[model samples]
Target chain A: MNNWYMLTLVGNDRTGIVAKVTRILQQNNCQLGEASMLRLGGNFTIMMMVNSELSSDDIITALQAISAELNLQVHLDEIEGRLHEHHIPNVLVTVIGADRGGIIAQVTEKLFNVGFDILNLDSDVAGTDERAIYIMRIEGQALDGIESIEAALQPLKADGIDISVQAIETLIA
Target chain B: MAIHPILTYPNQQLKQVSQPVDNFDHNLRAFIDELQETMHDGPGAVGIAAPQIGHAIRLVIVDVSNKKKIKHHGHLVLVNPEIVEWQGLAVGREGCLSVPDFTGNVVRAERIKLNAFDAYGEPLSFEMEGYEARALQHEIDHLDGLLFLDRLVSRRNDLFERKKR
Candidate 1:
């Protein structure tokens, strides 16, 4: 039986990182699964699920040459099951304002207290280094409905954070 | 008169362009009834297209009356529907019955002027805005074999995994 493993690689951003890493997996007969690969702050990060008959150590050994060639930090952990199971997101929350500390913490705390499970989140800084603007978009499911989620985030408005909550309804057409 | 099974992605039929409706006869009326029934059968489905049920015809049904505080044309059965004019642009999250596993943010026209035919082959023209316009645009796309995935605002970040209840 094939086993699932969470494989992660992080290093300085460079072209051909994906091509080289995926080629190694292909050569090793490792079946690729759901993956998220992106560049953040001059670093390329790859987090993916792989299914293979080989042991984790064997997979690591197979990747050793490419890892050293690209100077990438590679790590793998055996997982019991797949990690990309689908989840329907019910609410979309956007937070934008002057960059400051505790924005993520305070916003997440409000969501966590109400049993809201975040499915996807993306944050980025814009504007000049002298005046930076923090923008974050979070998609999640709110079991308690949008009104409650809105109420929970209402307090943040007082702090001059431009926040908006929208209900995400999927119309199948 | 029947609730047909929805054809999901990878069902190559969903990718083929649907033919324009030329005859609005007895068969067309019966098929329209089936489409309405199928739309009602889906979970929270406000619109549906003929191609979604494996029928490659230019036909769709939309009913946004159940939606609160939105102006809608009640029940709409558009035959050979086409958007003649559009205004503004907005990004909204959309999920499809054919692609149930994920939802994506798609850019759609905020307002639209549409021309279509009713079930009886009579010409109909109207204007729609807000959610109704978005729904119509999505249904019309099926006639051209375009899914929301094809129109995602940002492929890298707009697509999201949808949890099944």
Candidate 2:
């Protein structure tokens, strides 16, 4: 919680974004905490939470060079609070079905309705346009109200989607 | 006197096989008490092994009895244990007290008949199935220096290595 700042960078998805940004932060001696970059459609977007003694103006000045060079958009904001989360069950959910509108929408909605938090989700489409296959993986906590989120997903079968949910016990021997 | 700091992975001690406990002495009982307390203190921990606390002994404590899906209803102090028979394969997601932040799919035996001694040196055998059996197998694996990463279904698709903590 010391001199924390949130940085968001968006640009074309190609190469070297990580390399360039990390180098800048290293030069300024700033530490990167939680960072996420995702390619949405065709643009690559990055969100990084950082903590450092360096002032925001100093970090922003360094990143500005990369922003202009890479034709990227950058934003910097400071945070003045602590971040913490209660430990909860982490489950792996897989959904596969014909690529169609609302596959991600419907599955995620049901998971949320059943009190499961969707932490991360990634989906892809393959096969063919006439019968594209969509595969997705979601990991998150299942709140107390969820009797069995897997059972609630049974209705998705009507949409040609097959889903499976399993508890992630990564540390268990 | 109860809860101890659960060791995280990459800690060399977690990889070593534990030796069987032969003494039913006061110290052994005291260690078992600490293990139970540690397991209870862990957030949602169903079972734990001796090595997890840096104690290289064949001791494990499991009590999934209170878990809603599969409840057994008591503490299990297994010492110097052996799995005589096992059947069925069940793949479930699992995380560890030592390795927090990531979770993966693990395939474990659905049922097992385990022979072991109690903390007081009394011989005991257990017939476990479903969730309880899975938890027992996981704890026993710790005694043999096995982590769930060793039996992952598929590292590529079965892992949630990216953690947000």
Candidate 3:
């Protein structure tokens, strides 16, 4: 395979969000390798794996244009060499407790600052009125493994959030 | 005498709780051998339980050397195992051979003090930590007819159909 790319899009839920994003990638000759799409609350989430012989610059420019037009947040990163041979180090992060507005942004921002690439994430508001519970399993990849992550997430302790991390092996790019 | 085919989900056989080894007969030797063989045969496979091979016996063979993370932890073969005590809770993503095509977050005990009969029928007690504990617990759960799917603490948005390579 040629170079591999991971691109993600998240924004206000709208019709044709996927088609518009994919259409741009297809124009840039990016091969869709993997994809996951979901609508949570009022937002649409799209994560895709793409392959192209072109430089990261070419793909990023195309994605940036679409993000501007659609008002979506986007991220793109390239995988290379020996690191490409190893399976993406997917980590499962589970957070269970009461629901709140800034959970995704807060958790994901932590992951992003430390170079974690989210693969699949799904959350639901569970339980009844007196005791409400929110359970979410976010699948992500961090090639550096648990040591780096453990240090990066020390602040989460203040929030009384339970954290568990497991390194996963899934597909060589 | 050889690696046995893993009885995947919907096979019905994988869901049945295994019978306890009453006498440690010749058949028990063969069952343990096959479980060890099968674990070595798969690419990243570490352990195999009796139910996973269509046998309903309280036995599981684990060798974590093949897994990079727990390679230094060495091999563990547990027969009629019991976790005497455990401390603290840790969540990990666990997958089983019987439950092919998916993995999920499972909260399991982080450290375990347990006892089991070894290959020579001698009682042995040990304390295991980290990923090793998770792997051992996962295999033992199979002996009780519980697949990793049963331990899925959360659900993904989609069914996540696996396409064989």
Candidate 4:
């Protein structure tokens, strides 16, 4: 029987990180599952689901050599292997404005209050240091209908933030 | 007419380029009926292609009349369809009967004028815009062995997992 684990690795961004790590996993006879590997804030992070016959400790030990060599941090936790959980987003919300504190918090708070479940969110700061612009794109499900969700977020417009809510119609063609 | 099973992704047949329909006969009529039945059977299906039903032919059916508040040409049976002209580009999230697990944002023409033959082998030319145009492009893509997954705006950000209702 295979053991499932949620594995995470973080370290300074470098090339061949994925190649080295995956090669190690392959050598250990580890079967990889869903994984997201990306650079965030100059750090290369890998979050993946792994299935192996080895225990968590064994897996960690297997990765210990590369972890020490690359000065990377590796964490592993045994997890239930539930395949394929579907979560579809019904609405897309875009928020753009001058960089300010608590924009995400306030926007998320309103969504939480209205039972909106966010599936994915991406935010980035652009423009110059003196005039930074905060742009956030959110995909989520609005449990209470688009109108109510719009109303809940309408208050944020007063702060000079440009907010747009669009319904995602998934046409099966 | 019977509803045909839709061939999902990873089905090698869905990846092959479909052949053009040269002979429009009783058999073709029967197949079109089956395709229409299959489309109607699908949940929220607005268009369907021959390849989707494991028939590798350049035939597709599109109906946007059921969609509320959208200008549509009602039911369309496009045989050997080709886009003659198109204008504007817009991105919209699309799901497919073949790809049931996910939806993704795909850039499509906002307006398109296409020429195709009808079910009765009658030549037809029409223009479509907005949602209708998007649907037509998607269906036509199947003839060329392309899915919306192929035309995704961004593979990382545009693809979305679809929730089960």
Candidate 5:
């Protein structure tokens, strides 16, 4: 059986974390697969699935040594395998205009209830702090059509708040 | 001859920067005709680029005049087109025939002053606003090896997987 593992590393936000972690993994003859590194709030985090020749126990000991040295929280565990992109119809939902509370909640709730799969979402509070503007882009699968999704988002629109849902073929590009 | 096959991504040719259309000959006119035919054959297509038809030349056609209510320059064959000045911003949902199956919300110049040579090799310059301006910008990007994806507001969330048309 192939040895596939999920590895997560979180520590203070600093450079060289990736270099160090990957170097260790590289020394162990581990091939990095889908990996993501994110800086959240104040700390940084790294998550990846890797295929390796080393066993789980061997990887755990190697990672623990680095964890103690770098003041990081490291977790390594065996996993089944990987997930590939599915051939599903996806939609792009963009919401802009005035910033207000409960906007994300309201929008997400409606989309979720209607079978829209939230693949990716990014939002920002721009304009000015006094006249705070909220802009968001959501990529997901809308099982229904764009018209129905638009209708679902209709109530969210006000004088300045604009919400639009349209079919997007994102994977193509 | 007739409608040519639209090249999709990874075709290498789509990314190659197009050379300027230096000559306005019979072949150029026929190529423009083929592009018009291809655009009409596409699903709600508004414009097409020469690179999309395997010709790396600065030439594109746009005809949004027939679709809905919008002031337009009618069917235009802009050769070596350039946007001299731009103003304001408009966000519109756009799809490309070459990049089929996907559409994106792109922010474009709400108004523009464009300068270009017509299909007959005559110099033409004019101002375009609203939908017409947006369409011209989208088609022009293709000549410069740019796709709507490159202009997406946010790649992570702005990109959507479209259902097959």
Candidate 6:
């Protein structure tokens, strides 16, 4: 049995971000399980879940070396127990209003600050419509006693965005 | 007592129409036992149909009382149940034990008047509302060799592919 890990590395977009990144993984005997790498605003963002048979620190050290060479900000964490991924709550939040410069930054900053992980997201601002629609589903281990987290996101109301939260448990039914 | 493996889709048994029970005898009882046992053995299985277990009989056992949304439906063991009438339409995403890894939105009748025989071979007719009715119709569709994927209005953006675990 091997350890499973999730790594998120983001940095300036370059030609060899993948080759440099995965070379380290290969050296550490890590199998590339699942990964998605994309370019966003001139930066390369990678999200991957991998399986390994090595100690966590060994893998972290290997990635650290590559990160320094590539000038990438890399974060590695082990996928925890059931509470961390399996039983985590999932919520869908949608915002429909005039498209402005800070819509994504504002909405996502609030979500991240409140301890929500963007699991699967698809959003399009579209052409110059009077109102641009934004919809996203955030999945994460609910922050302990999420009532206050909910309160923090309430300020989005002033931006004229509609927000709703539904537990992923309900979706299983 | 016997517990049977539920036949997931891409298996022929899940798509075959089940035959109606012509008599209340040992075979019928045997089918009922196997259906219940199989459903209990499955994860989150609320119902099982004859075609799923290779019987090909129009029989299904449903007990959604263990589920969150339709526990109010109670425990039901139906043999050759028929939907005599239906009213209105309700839409909800549905999945099946036979199709282990996929779900789709399906529109079904909201309320239904049904008639069927109980496990004891006694005749029963009743009306079902809400989620209970939805679960009932889902199982019945299996009797006619229908899968929830067949009723989906359009292709889902994400069609989950199950890998051996």
Model 4 stretches with alpha carbons more than 4 Å out? B155-165
lDDT of 5 by residue, A6-88 (tens): 99889998877888888998998888877777776467888898788788888878777777878889888889775554334
Q: Write the per-residue lDDT of candidate 1 for residues A1-173, one digit (tens) a residue.
A: 55899999999999999999999999999999888898877899999989999999999999999999999999999987654367878888888899999999999999998889998888888887999999888889999998888999999989999888888865556
- Return the lDDT, model 4, position A151: 95
Model 6 C-alpha lDDT per residue in residues B1-165, reported as the tens digit of each score: 888777777887778888878898886787788788888887776677788777788887777676555435578888889999998785555777777555555777878999999766899887987667788888898889888878886322222221111
**Which docking class does model 3 fall in?**
incorrect
Best-first order by TM-score: 4, 1, 2, 5, 6, 3
Order of candidate numbers by DockQ, starting with the best: 4, 1, 2, 6, 5, 3
For residue A23, what is the lDDT in candidate 5? 91
Best by DockQ: 4
After aligning candidate 2 to the native by TM-score, how far in Å is the CA of B109 from where it should be? Answer: 4.6
Question: Scored by CA lDDT, what does every candidate get?
Answer: 0.88, 0.78, 0.71, 0.88, 0.79, 0.70
Better of 1 and 2 by DockQ: 1
Candidate 5's docking class is incorrect
Q: At residue A168, give the lDDT of candidate 4.
A: 79
Q: For candidate 3 chain A, which ten residues in a row score worst on lDDT?
A: A80-89
DockQ of each: 0.48, 0.26, 0.07, 0.52, 0.10, 0.13
The positional error of residue A5 in candidate 2, measured at the CA in angstroms, is 3.3
Instruction: Count clashing pairs, candidate 2.
Output: 12
> TM-score: which is higher, 5 or 6?
5
| Superposition TM-score, candidate 3 onto the true structure | 0.56
lDDT of 5 by residue, B76-136 (tens): 8899999999998755567677765556567788799999998889999989987788888
**Deviation in Å, model 3, residue A146 alpha carbon:** 6.6
lDDT of 2 at A96: 76
Q: Interface root mean square deviation of every model, in Å? A: 6.4, 7.9, 10.8, 6.1, 8.3, 10.2
- TM-score for chain B considered on its own, for each of the candidates: 0.92, 0.90, 0.85, 0.92, 0.90, 0.87
Cα-based TM-score, every candidate: 0.92, 0.71, 0.56, 0.92, 0.63, 0.61
